[model samples]
Target chain A: MQNKMIGYVMILAMLLFGGLSTVQAADGAKATNPEAAKVEKMIADADKARKKAASVEGEWRDVGKMLKKAKAALAKGDYKTAKKLAAKAKSQGEMGYKQAVAQKDLKMPSYLKY
Target chain B: MKHLLKKIAMLAVAGGIAASAQASPEADREAFQNFYKNRFASVPMEEYPNGVYSIDPVGRENWEAIEEFPPYEPFIDEGQAMWEKPFANGKTYKDCFADGPAIAGIYPLWDKKNGMVITLPLALNKCREANGEKPLKYKKGSINDILSYIAYESRGQKTNVIIPKDDPRALAAYEKGKKFYYTRRGQLNFSCANCHLQNAGMNIRADRLGPALGHTTHFPVYRSKWGTVGTLHRRVTGCNKQVRAKPFKAQGEQYRNLEYFLTYMSNGLELNGPGARK
Candidate 1:
């Protein structure tokens, strides 16, 4: 009855708006300390890593490509492959992040370094 | 098909009642998806009844509860002992300030001579360092010296943070913080102002949004997630991770400046230090 109608409405709503966050990611982190020296170093390191990740020749086109594949798998309800690639990309990203934060004498969060 | 529809309706009603009674992360996520799609940035800025880490109704709260909290009573006792210990000229902790508790509001003020802002916590550390004792971190033992003494001193004093409106230096520091809040810098590409300033009541994953205003009133509260009491800097570090940004050092200039801005936002709120947080 009414309950069935509400369930249908709710699922449809999630499909319509599940992807968007409350705030747009495009204009995110405006309150971050840009002049933070440690953050600067880490950003530089991550940039280098991003470039390096993008330039791989044989198996990996880039983390971007992998992420796209991961995203596609996700859209297709393939959680297993999506989780694997996301984990892989995370490790590569973490490696570069480690070098950057370490070089600048900053304490790394466990997730980034370990 | 009609019978099936009736069955589905009955099941759905039962499920909704159950889900409402016992909400799970999955249920909350679905709620956020239904109610707040992408409004993850702005947070509510009103005074929350229970002072904990600022909550963004729109996002998932990372820290849940701290099983064990470090007892500040022992630390405060040590601070008291340190305060009672004599200084160079046989000066007692009482000699340090005419009225110790009356001093908390005057700190983190604009220092025109230094062209910077100084916090009372920093000032106390500076006094200790100048007199040859190691300065303590904001929530560490040395802070206990101030907090314990100031806790005694904190009686009847105002909890307002006063920054001169005309001072450009203060404004500069504030603007820096403002920029940090609005700019997207992390892997998740989220900002503090996004959750705290803009979307206070919007649901993120499971938790309700909270306002950033008056956020400073409940610092150094016992957190269940860390299993101990800590300061706002530690909480900020946790947030950096949520957004996938590299966290600046706790109590570093950035956090201090941000504290300055946050205190300014909570200017008129009374001091309720050592609060409790989830």
Candidate 2:
């Protein structure tokens, strides 16, 4: 009887600890989704880039809309879609800012006589 | 010897300043008109008020046919009725604009008191608010109605947008507008000059890009694509969007300044608003 009781105690401990470990692992995943975090960072960068472009009145129409869509994808845990969109938006923002900066001095077109 | 040196230095400085200073509005206008004159040697200066139709012979035939039974006629009639109708405050638009509806040529002017460009649509809205009436939407709706009537009546009045010499701000506004025109924006990275100025009379897909000259003479245009009469700002908004850039608000400082510059370009062109277009 003593041996049987010891065996049952060991099995019970294993089941309890195993179940607890599984729950902990799930909690860990929920708390620290590296992919989600990366996507959020990308979105933040895109927003900063967009604002920089807008500061010079160089913002493209779809950059804002793209950022919004990226955030929505991020909320839905669609990291791939979010990252792709955020990257495009950031690129567009940079392009627009560069475009405006390049024309800082009004270089009237060659065709247009001053 | 020192006095002579100082006078020479002062003369050099003055010459530099004169050279660096942007061409006056009049000079700019002359250059702008001359560009089109040289490009379309066959098309007369007076024919420009007809827009792209002046250059496109085939399109001009269709445009002439459309004009015979003018689509904008009802809008003009509606605008006339609105003009005649009294406001809620027992005042009509005439009360505010004593000069009356034929006053479209006078607009897109510098409002010295406001330190801003005041467009016709904005003036009309102010008139409405002053008379205790609801302001109309800028891009579309009944605003086009009243504007159609005003433009129709104002036909033949020359587009003479004066940037007052007294107010330096007026010239600054024109400069801002000129900058805006040349600046590239949007995903397409196209400036207003890319299509309208650089590629004027060139076909983009099926549509021939119209010349920037006389662009502002016809406003409140009835475009077949729109199927309704829309203001110049409305067309401007569409152009921005076409290039995939965000559009500025109608009558907003940016657009008003743009209108000021654009109208100034069309100076001496006959007012031919409430125009039909494809």
Tens digit of per-residue lDDT, candidate 1, span B137-225: 76433564446445444533444555566677776776455445444544454557667545666557765556555566655545556
Candidate 1 chain A: 10-residue stretch with minimal lDDT: A105-114
lDDT of each: 0.51, 0.86
Chain A TM-scores in order: 0.37, 0.71
> In lDDT terms, how accurate is model 2?
0.86
Docking class of 1: incorrect
User: Model 1 residue B113 lDDT?
Assistant: 76
Candidate 2 lDDT, B4-103, residue by residue in tens = 9999999997665444236777877887888898889999889999999989999999999999999999999999999999998788999989988899
Q: Model 2 chain B: which ten-residue window has the lowest total lDDT? A: B13-22
Evaluated at residue B153, the lDDT of candidate 1 is: 42
Give the local distance difference test score of model 1. Answer: 0.51
Considering every candidate listed, which one attains the maximal DockQ?
Answer: 2
**TM-score of candidate 2 chain B vs. the reference:** 0.92
